[model samples]
Target: MVRILQQKQFVGHEIHGKSHKYYPLITKETYTKSFMKGFVRRYFSGSYRQMVSFFTKEDNLSLHELEQLLKELKDKNS
Candidate 1:
């Protein structure tokens, strides 16, 4: 919690009566995007394809999920 206070992007804090309260400084979507980018960079060489390939090979992605992913990609490209 103390560490979170240091990153202005992550949270804001309130001090009251010798106690501290913290609240998010960024939206959930923004934080998730930042976190996933760092995770992919650190673990998958910054390649989203490599990340998806790893999950597919590990049987982590369901067939329906894969199809949905492909559909989204196609829609994006279209």
Candidate 2:
């Protein structure tokens, strides 16, 4: 997640564990499984070919099953 923007001062606000140069300051939202899958595909899949390669390599998930999941993910978005 990230946080609200602060003024671009020479320095930034620091509250012990608040934030730093590399750390994000905003919050992250949670999504359902179907949504997450679709989101991953939409933003990161690049193409169906890459998606299949990643799916199999990552978890040995069958292409057929991943295709089904992709459909479900599409449905959720629609």
**TM-scores of all candidate predictions against the true structure:** 0.83, 0.30
Q: Candidate 1's residue-wise lDDT over 1-78, tens digit each?
A: 557545655777788899988777778999789899999999999999999999999999999999999999999999
Q: Which runs in model 1 stand beyond 4 Å of their true positions?
A: none
Clashes of each: 0, 6
| Model 2 lDDT per residue over 2-78, tens place | 23334322233545666455433333342245456786679777466676677689987987888898899899999
Compare the candidates by TM-score and give the number of the best one: 1
Q: List the residue pairs that clash in candidate 1.
A: none
Model 1: ten consecutive residues of lowest lDDT: 1-10
Alpha-carbon RMSD, candidate 2 = 8.5
Estimate the TM-score for candidate 1.
0.83
lDDT of 2: 0.61
